[model samples]
Target chain A: MSLHLQPVRVATSSDDSESQLVFAEGFLVAMLVHLSEQHEDDAGRWFLEAGFGRIPSRDHPTFLDLDEAQTWIRQQLGNAYVS
Target chain B: MASNFTHPLFPLIRKLDSIATLTDEERQAVENLPVRIRALRARHEIVRHGEKASQCCLILEGWACRSKVISEGKRQIFSFHIAGDIPDLQSLHIPLMDHDLCTLTQATVAFIPHEAVRDLTMRFPSIAAVFWRDTLVDAAIFREWMISMGRRTAFDHLAHLFCELYLKQQAVGLAGEHRCPLPITQGDLADATSLSNVHVNRVLKEMRGKGLITLRSNTLVIEAWDELIRAAEFDATYLHLQKRAVP
Candidate 1:
């Protein structure tokens, strides 16, 4: 199943507020925040702000773009469903 | 005796003196203790987990840390040590190291034999008491860390750590005027505080934005010490430094 990403703003209490809400089969699966300029080298990267349903909180990962994030999210969701 | 008192092992005396009063004889005994000195490169492991250690490492210069690695290379740093700290003092009694101890920066360290330490303690009960007191304070610091990990927000937890680091240095005359060396990298802070690197970066920026502190060139200057302490609700009482360093 393909993932749907809805562009949104997150109040992360920091400069990195631009975010996206991901949906898998109409169920919200994760939220990703865009790293702000304050992050220096990591700026412009997308960070997994939160993940639900077998996507552990400990895996706070950063991706190069939304495409990579969605792909990773799909993998996580796919693993969750298979297992 | 004065010339001998100016020994390389003087940092140990200073460290112990920071916690409790050391009589002349006690100080002399420590100064006279034989130590094999070595200059270690940054990140060099001094004692590995499960290794039976025959000696303890004392930090003569720079910094070190006690840490353990779990599955997938995730490291949890238990404590950051500075000059005068015996990072593996427990190894004197325990022999087997439970966590790995390593230098955080290029460091000068003195290795003190366990036999000598045990003999010294056996002869000087007061020195032994001070050592016991040191371990107790170490446990107290751990309790604070537990609170930060379980309850405090990332911002508060980091603030508390900064305060602790500054005061610890100040007590030993290594720091003053709300300023201290912060040579540790952001990644190290993440491991110590149980936060992600991204999270640590954000908190540090927030701290900078709010004018709480300025970390530059491996130095941390607490610009708003009062406000920071208030925000973190830091109580120095837990540190139990007998001669509390003037902040």
Candidate 2:
């Protein structure tokens, strides 16, 4: 399946007021979360909390670093990834 | 041409046509089958578990379902039926009902005596084969549901069900363009999917948030057909529809 992600700009006031959050839409958020699984390694078992909706939100720890996570997201999105 | 409402057997013919071809003589025989038409309110039981049924209930209009109640009064819905579906056809051979068949909405049903169905099958062997195939397809669907319940996540199982229902309705010309009448509640879906009502609600919210489907007021529209199919890993082969084209 092809999932296209388009950036959505929204302003909000939070505890981290100086921080800006970029939300993306068009990803199959539910499917992606269902497909992801917890992994155990030498570092121990880690949980990944992939959020739903147009913008992908993650609060849980990840096995993949920033670059790797971006690549994985791009791969899951197929040719639909904009950036 | 007379309206289908004039012929009580037209729905059966339409259903069988999706799986098998019937000759003109056979069609005439079906058209001549005697039936006792009844109007039933929603939630009424047509056949109760352990009861001996002398007739088969063919849904002429509205939705019905087969279900079994377990301990604690929890119900497990086996399948949902629409117009032209004989929800209790197995009763012709089994005699005793193992589960309950009930109306999901205000329904019009045609109850054909077992003797008449038996005579038709005896006189027309080809028609008998068609009926046999229909029962076998029912078993195939049961097997698929078993797989979904055991192996698939709630999301995938629900998506797979939507695909199956849509295709089945489309085969009978009741649905098209990824939209169909669902007429089911979240509680009913929870029973069918073996999930809690809260879980079903959350999953439905996720589905809507992702724009995968739009379900409202007894209607469901698949917004992303290909994505839904992929998520469900759905294939229409199990349905065994003869005319696969979407009309």
Candidate 3:
């Protein structure tokens, strides 16, 4: 059977303002998050390692908060998921 | 008689012969059909969506695909065509194009008028039956694709596509020995398979690691045909090739 993305609940840390929205499908887990400044470098490295690229001059959009990150994830998923 | 290769309907004749035999008179009629040949560059649009087509585009050389651009400029490719294939043959009856037909490589195309096609079909019932059968087979392929998208895994879908394409090219004498020309990009494959480019690359890597197939320099070589077929659960019944290869 084909793998399909299923959205999991959004999680937020009490000590930090950083938010993560997780999506799961079979053995794959995709995490979309509003990266804090300390985590930006690590996130960029991870994105590059994941083939998303991390060229400094590249115009990759950065979301400042959870709502923007959630919207971006939704847009990427398109009609692949229900609700 | 001079060489049949010199005939205007050579590609069409070869195509029909792969599906059904034609009488001498029917062959003559096809040779006499009016056509305007055009050479197009890769990515050139032969016909656009919402356009009322007056002629059908027949691929004499190179490849073409029918696709639709959806939201976010994401294009979904429906079918690929090669020599002896009419990418827009449905336009003869439908009149209006609901999707775009474009070249995937530098291509030689013959534009046959719908009026002429209609006249030919009316005069030759046997030839008309062949064309009808061709369209029916096209529908069958579409159904198979829908099944692939709805039920098959990405690896299975890619394997199935490779199997189908190889058989198609082999039927037309363009491929043999489990190898075929695959002049399409990872992105193109992604569009056709409804997967992302990254995912396609990953799947291809997995296939390579499994020793199932090798795709390089626009050529795909099936290293283990039986294994690839098994992975895909592929059956060529829907393809309807007259001279089907035993797998």
Best by lDDT: 1
C-alpha lDDT score of every prediction, in listed order:
0.89, 0.74, 0.76
lDDT of 1: 0.89
CAPRI-style docking class of model 2 based on DockQ: incorrect
Off by over 4 Å in 1: B1-6, B244-247
Computed on C-alphas against the true complex, the DockQ of each candidate is: 0.69, 0.02, 0.06
Per-residue lDDT of candidate 2, residues B110-186 (tens digit): 99999999999999887788788778889999999999989998789989999999998999989999999999888
Mind giving the per-residue lDDT tens digits that candidate 1 earns over A1-83? 67788999988778888999988878888889999998888999999989888666776889999989888888787745522
Q: Write the per-residue lDDT of candidate 2 for residues A3-78, one digit (tens) a residue.
A: 3433332221111112112133533442221111111121222122344442244222233333344444545445
Candidate number with greatest DockQ: 1
Single out the weakest 10-residue window by summed lDDT for candidate 2 chain B.
Answer: B238-247
Highest TM-score: which candidate?
1
Question: lDDT, candidate 1, residue B49?
Answer: 98
Predicted candidate 1 versus true structure: per-residue lDDT over B161-235, tens digit per residue: 999999999988899999999999999999999998889998998999999999999999999999999999999
Residue A3's lDDT within candidate 1 is 79
Ranking by lDDT: 1, 3, 2
Model 1 chain B lowest lDDT segment of ten: B238-247
